[model samples]
Target: MADPLPGDVIDRVEYDVERGKVREFTRATFTTDPVHTDLPAAREAGFDDVPATLTHTVVAGHQRDQRGFVDALGLALERVVVGSVTWTYLRPLIAGDHVIGTRRVVGDERREGKRGGTMRVVTLETEYVAADGEPVVRLEEVLIERGEQR
Candidate 1:
C-alpha cells in the first residue's frame, strides 16, 4: 500500500461496550472506582449503566483491529513507535452502548531527527460516535517511524 496521506480514511469499526468487558477492564487496570464495574454505583453516579473508563476506547480499538492504522499504512512494525496519545471525551460511554469509530489520517509530515536521520510523523484521529450519531470520544495517536538507523 502507498503511504497514507492526510485525510485518508483508514477504516471504520464498531465496538460494543459489554458489561463483562467493562468489569474486566476495570479490574485489569486496577481501577477501584465502582462506577466502572457496578451498575448501581453507575446509576447513582448519574449514568444509565456501568460507564467505561476513559481509556477503555484503547481496548475496544485493539479488540476491533489488532493491526490498526500502522499496519494499514504498511509501515514496518519494528520501526514504528507510538509517540503519544490524546483523548477527548464528549460524553460518557456506558455498558450496552454501541459505538462506531472511524480512523483517518489527519496529519503526515517528515522532520529531521536530531541524530541525523529523517523521521516520519503520522497523526491518526479516530472519532467514536454513539448509536444516536452523536460523537462520544475522539482519539488522536501519533506514530513516529524512525528512519533507517545510522
Candidate 2:
C-alpha cells in the first residue's frame, strides 16, 4: 500500500462524555482526584463540571480505529506496537460535553531493521474538540509496524 500523505485524515469519531462513564474510568484508573469523579469537587477546583481524565480522549479515539488504520497499511495487530504517546491539553473535558475527535496522518517513515524486516513508523495526531469548536486535547501517537516485508 502506498503511504498516506502527511495531511491525510485517517478517521473521525464523536463521543459524549457521560458522567457515569467518567466516574467509572476514574475508579478503574485508580484516580483519587475528586475533580474527575465529583462535580462539587471539580467546581471547587475551578472546573465547570466533572472533568474526565486526559487519557479518555485516547481511549475514545482508538476504540474502533485500531484495525481500520492498521489494515489500511497492510499490517496486522500483532505486528503493530505503540512507540510513544504525548498529550497536549488545551482545555478540560467535562461530563455532558459533546466531542469530535479527528485522527490524521502527520508523518510516516520506512526503515530496514537489523533483523532484515521492514518497519513502518506512523505518526498520527488526534485532536478532540468540543461542540463549540474549542480544542479540548490533542494526542500525538507514534506506532511502529513490524514485518511489513516479511
Candidate 3:
C-alpha cells in the first residue's frame, strides 16, 4: 500500500453533542460521573448540560468509520492496533454544542518489527471546535498497521 503523505487532511466532520448520546456513552464506559449523564448535575458543575467524556471525541469525530483514509490506504482493520492517543481539552464539550472536527495525517513511518515483519505507524491529529468556534479538544491518535513477514 502506498503511504499516506504527511499533513494530509483526512476528514472534516460536523456532529452534535446530544444529551442522550452523552448519557449512553457515560453508562457504557462505566463512567458513573453525574456530570456526564445528569443535566442538573452538569449545571451544578457550571455547565448548561451534560458534558461528553474524554474519549467521546473518538465517536464524535467519526474516527471509527472504516472509510476514507483507512480504506484509501488499504489497511486491514484486523491488523491495525491503536499505538497511542493523547487528548488535550480546552473546554468542556457540553450537550447541544455542535462540533466541527478536522482530522489530519500528521506523521507516518515504517519500522522493522521484532517478529521480522514491517510495521507502519500512522498518526492522526484532530482538532474539534464548538459551534461558537472555540477549540474544545485536540486529539492525537497513533495507529499501527502490521504487515506479514516478507
TM-score of each model, paired residue for residue? 0.93, 0.89, 0.88
lDDT of each: 0.87, 0.84, 0.83
Q: Please list the residue runs of candidate 2 whose C-alpha ends up more than 4 Å from where it truly belongs after superposition.
A: 61-65, 114-116, 148-150
**Per-residue lDDT of 20-132 in model 3, one digit per residue for the tens?**
88887888889988899877888899998888987887775353465666786567877899999999999888889898988888988889988787898999898999887
Task: Rate residue 82 of model 2 by lDDT.
Answer: 92
Angstrom error of the Cα, residue 91, model 1: value is 0.4
Show where candidate 1 strays beyond 4 Å: none
- List, residue by residue over 47-92, the lDDT tens digit for candidate 1: 9999998788876556566576557876778899999999999998
Residue 122 lDDT in candidate 1: 88
User: After superposing candidate 3, which stretches have Cα over 4 Å from the reference?
Assistant: 61-65
When summed lDDT is taken over every stretch of 10 residues in candidate 2, the lowest stretch is 58-67
- Best-to-worst order by TM-score is 1, 2, 3
* TM-score of decoy 3: 0.88
Comparing candidate 2 with candidate 3, which one achieves the higher TM-score? 2
The count of backbone overlaps in candidate 3 is 0
Q: Model 2 — TM-score against the truth?
A: 0.89
